[model samples]
Target: MKKNLIMSFVLSTLLVTVLSGCGAASKSTTGTADDTKAPAATTTTKSEKSTTLRIGYQKYGTVNFLKANGELDKALKEKGITIQWTEFPGGPQLLEAMNVGSIDVGHTGEAPPIFAQAAGTPLVYLGHEPASPASEAILIPEKSEIKSVAELKGKKVALNKGSNVHYLLVKQLEKAGLKYEDIQVVFLPPADARAAFEKGSVDAWVIWDPFFSAAETSAKAKILADGKDTVANHEFYLATRNYAENNKETVKIVLDQLAKVDTWSKDHPKELAETLSPQLGIDVPSLERAAKRRAYGIQPIDDALINEQQKIADTFFKLGLIPKEIKVKDAVLPATK
Candidate 1:
């Protein structure tokens, strides 16, 4: 009986040991499964973190329409991405922000980038906006008899130097067979130029956009000449060289969103004007008129575009607006297939 009891105790001890070992093995297997899943979880977290894109834009353009619609922000959010929008007063200011790495992408007219490029600012042309000539013009007061570009030869012409209107003025003068020196050029911001025009301080104003439209309606200014005969007057989408190379995926997203906005602007001109009116503090009627005249599409940056830009650079150089000639091709991003 003593032997049997001892045998029973031994058996009990062995069974307990086996059970504990099995429990530990099961825990080990579970822990390994969890360890394997960690990498995938980490990868997903990294992807989520990369989805935020920063974009910069100015008022008085299709970007405003995009901002008002809010579709882009929603679309990006679904892809685990967020968009941060920043606004500037105009293209020149936006390009300046881009130059300093404050902005990732923005739009500007033909002249601002040329001036920026000549200054050796680090930027790249990502895309082109379709040509819009009617949006920019040289304006004279209603009662003024400045019928031809030549009539303003000796008069002081107000323009934003280094802006697209500057190029327009130069080209128009050249077309009239007059030197840029023949006219007294006054460099003024849009606000100051408007005030000067109202106060009868400026003989003529060469300008663009809502301001041009405003001057035409409110100031009773007559169009001396539109950009039609002289310049392509197309706007450009520019990005910093570093930002574009580092964040191609983000760049593509921004471009795609911009194209969508361009489409919307074309389809809903009146609605766009109403949507933007409150934001810009401009009347809807004027915005509608300006919207009608502007282009609403995107084009890839290519050789033909570059050639057009090169002509602008050459003109600026000849007029001594820029210190040296800049090759537009060198500043353009590589063609995307």
Candidate 2:
């Protein structure tokens, strides 16, 4: 009877062990516990995107307008990226901040990047806006006798050095048969330039809109000559090489956002002006004029465009404006299809 009981107990224990093993196998097949944890970890890794994209912009840039509208911020937020916007009074100052790692991506007129690159900044040209030559010009106070670009020779000319207007001044001087040495170039930011222009200390101010338009509306500044037949005045989107290399998709997204803004602004000039007026602190009329003159489209930097930029760089180097001769192509970030 004792032998019979021992055999019966062993059989019952084997049955329980078998049932537990089957339960564990069923759980594994349905992805419970240990089996379920891996996919969850992978899903989290794929979705938990995180990074900050710092964009540096000048006061009147369209990118700033884009930021104010929150299009870029909204678009980037979905990809687990946040945008940090920093405003600068001028492109040169913006790029100066960039050189010290304070900025990741930014936009500037064609010249600022050239200056920044020549100064050993790791600037990467991502894209460019269509040429907006009519958006910038050499202005004189309406009451001033300086009527043409040629007449300003031997007078004090105010402009931001290493700016788009700087190139305009150079070319305008060449066209007017005046040497750069003939005019006393007063390097000043937009506000100070406006002040000097108003104070009658600076005879002519070379500037870009909406400052260009504001000067005309509020200060009665007259255009000596616009860039229509001179410089291309292409606005450039730039970044550090490091940023462009790591965040390629983010760069593409920024350009895509810019294109959308360009399309909308081109269609709704009045609305664009009204929206930007408060941000720029200029009147709607002035902002409208400025908006109307801007060429609203974004283009990738191509060989021809690179060649154009190279000409600007070479010109600066020849004139002893930039400290060293540099190739614009060296700063360009090649597009990966």
Model 2 residue 57 lDDT? 70
Task: Tell me how far the alpha carbon of residue 103 in candidate 2 is from the true structure, in angstroms, after superposition.
Answer: 0.7
lDDT of 2 by residue, 79-175 (tens): 8787666666778877776676666788999899889999999888988889999999999988888777888878999999899999999999999
lDDT of model 2, residue 136:
96
lDDT of 1 by residue, 1-337 (tens): 9999999999999987754442121111111132111011011121233454546566687666776788777777777766556665556656655555455567788999999899887889888789999899999988897789988889999987688898899889989989999989998878889889888898999999988998887888899999996888998888777667766776777789889889878878789899988877888888899999988798898778888888999988987889998887888767541
Strongest candidate by lDDT: 2
Worst 10 residues of 2 by lDDT: 36-45
Whole-model lDDT values for every prediction: 0.77, 0.81
- TM-score winner among the candidates? 2
TM-score for candidate 2, residues paired by index: 0.84
> Model 1 compared with the native: what TM-score?
0.82
TM-scores of all candidate predictions against the true structure? 0.82, 0.84
